[model samples]
Every structure is written in structure tokens, then in C-alpha cells.
Target: MHERMIIAGFGGQGVIMAGKLLCIAAMNENKYVSHIPSYGAEMRGGTANCSVVISDKEIGSPTVPKPTIAVVMNTPSLTKFEPMVKPGGLLIYNSSLIDQKPKRTDITVVDVKANDISEAEGSTRAANMAAIGKVLALKPEIASLESVIKALDVAISARNRKHNDINIKVLKAAFAQK
Candidate 1:
């Protein structure tokens, strides 16, 4: 299946990493995937967004104007992307970071306490994985959990084993919870 998704948040929120994980998973699944990151001055404390397109056929444009799903890890992300998602699309928001409810009725909004969940899981920085897990839940076509683990191992390396494990656990837990 073909799907275009946007994962957005602030810098240091692991927004880019989350998008990378999705791209890697899609590659492992042998799907055509393209990842484009949106960068601006607010990267550090500002906005972070990635556009990913997965399709059975060749992708025509790398930029995503209307995504089928938008994973928002912060209030700004939620606010910026919530209105741009296609009607009947899926929106996954880090409820812990965004308290305001999404007003869009055309799309189904799934709000989860991603940050709090990851913090409870002992990886406060893994809120991105929490978001990824939620997205993977809605679309089971993602790479297997095993693939995600391997990718994480490469992403984090052995230097930070404890952090890696915690994030992995968070991702798995999110999968089940989702």
C-alpha cells in the first residue's frame, strides 16, 4: 500500500529519528520510500517536521503537501500539521505535549501520552519512538519489530546501551498499547 506521512515536533524531540525509523522500516519491507526533512530556525527549540512517502510505485514528488497521516510530537507540530492532513486521514499527537484537543472532524485524531509514557519507561527522550509505535500500530505494513530493533541498535550503537534498551522497550510497549 502507498501512504504519505508527516512526523513533526521540535528539535531534540527525536522527530527526525522517528522519521528515519519509518523510512528504514519501509526499506526493509521493500517499499519505495522517500524522506524529506523540513528545517528552519526553530530547529533547536523550534519546529521539526519530516515528510515520508511510501508507495508501491515510484514516488513522483518528494515533498508532501497533503499527507495521509501526521504524527505530531508537540503542540506546534499538532497545530501546524493538524490542519494540513487530508480528510479521513490519521493524526497521532503526543497528548502529553499537547493538551488542546484537535478540532478537525474530517480526520481521526489519536492522542496518546507519548512523553509521559516514555518517561515512565525510563527513556524520556524516546517520545519519538512512542510516536513511531503509535503510527506503526495504525499501519501494520511497517517493518517487523525485529527490524526496528536492529535499526535502533545501529542508530544508537553500543555506547548507549541502557538508553537504547529503554527506547526499545518503549517502542515495543507502545506497539502493544497501540
Candidate 2:
């Protein structure tokens, strides 16, 4: 099995962190994984994205030209990566940030209120986790939920560990809603 995914958003939205968590989770499952990140110079509100590939077999490259799944957290990201999702792939976007619906009809589109959910959970920063949870629910074969929880323990920094509980809450809530 193979899954090539792209997670895009403005910097400081945790787009790169989300990709890292996905890769860590895939690694936890003993899958071959690759993560490549790109970002603008600014610390926040600048373009940021990452390409992640998880496969049961050997991975030839880290870059993904056409992703099977695209998770966009902002309008700019949606506009940029929406067209890159393969037909019959999944496009998950943050509805709280994107005002319009995706134009494609061949691929499945999911609008997740990630920011709102994270806000309701008392931490808006965890919107990325909510988005990832939605993807996990939609594609259970990608990685196990337990693996994600474990990845958080390793991927999150020491200063941010306090928010782990709420992040887990947001993830569980999204998974339950799915």
C-alpha cells in the first residue's frame, strides 16, 4: 500500500509539524516513509507545505508531483494544491479558512472545520491535529490512531507538551465525528 499526501498552509499553522507527525506514525507502523518540507522566509503567515509518502514497499523518492491526499488549511493553500490532487483522491480543507468549494468532481472533497473545532477544544493551534484526525478517519489504512497519539509524544516540543491533552481531545473528537 502507498499513500502520497501533501499538507499545505501558512507558516505557524503547523503544516510541517502535521506532516512530521504523519511520517512518524507511518514509521511507528514500520512503513517506509518520506517527508519533505518547503516554506517561505517569514516565520508566520508565509506559505508552508510538505510532501509525505508512506508505503509498504521501498520508497524511490521523497517528492510527490501528484498527491493522493491533499490537506489544505488556508485559501491560498487550497488554490495552490487543490489542482495537484489526483483524480479519485481525497482533498481535505479547512472550511473555516476557505470560503469556496473545490472545483473538482472526480476526487472526494472534505470540508473540515478544523480551526473551529480546535478553538472549541480550547486551543486553536491544534487545528492541524483535527485535520489529521479527519484524514485518519477517512483513510483508516493510512495509519493507526494509536500511532498518531504516540507520534505526538515524540514530534511535539518540550514547551508545547502541555497542550498534548487538548490536542488528543481534538483528535478524538474529530475521529468520533467522522
TM-score leader:
2
lDDT per residue, candidate 1, 1-178, as tens digits? 8889998888789887788877877787788889988866534555788889988788889888898999998887877888899999999988898889999999998987899889889866889888887777778775667777777766664776668778888888888894
Compose the digit string of candidate 2's lDDT tens values, residues 1-178: 8999999998789999999998999898999999988745532454688999999999998888899999999998898888989999999999988899999999999999999999999997899999999999998888988999999999999999889999999998888775
The ten-residue window of minimal lDDT in model 2 covers 38-47
Quote the lDDT for 115 in model 1.
90
Each prediction's Cα lDDT score?
0.82, 0.90
Query: Once model 2 is optimally superposed onto the true structure by TM-score, how far is the C-alpha of residue 41 displaced, in angstroms?
Result: 8.9
Give the C-alpha lDDT of model 2: 0.90
Model 1 vs. true fold: TM: 0.91
Model 2 lDDT, residue 78, Cα = 90
For lDDT, the strongest prediction is: 2
Clashes of 1: 1
TM-score of each: 0.91, 0.95
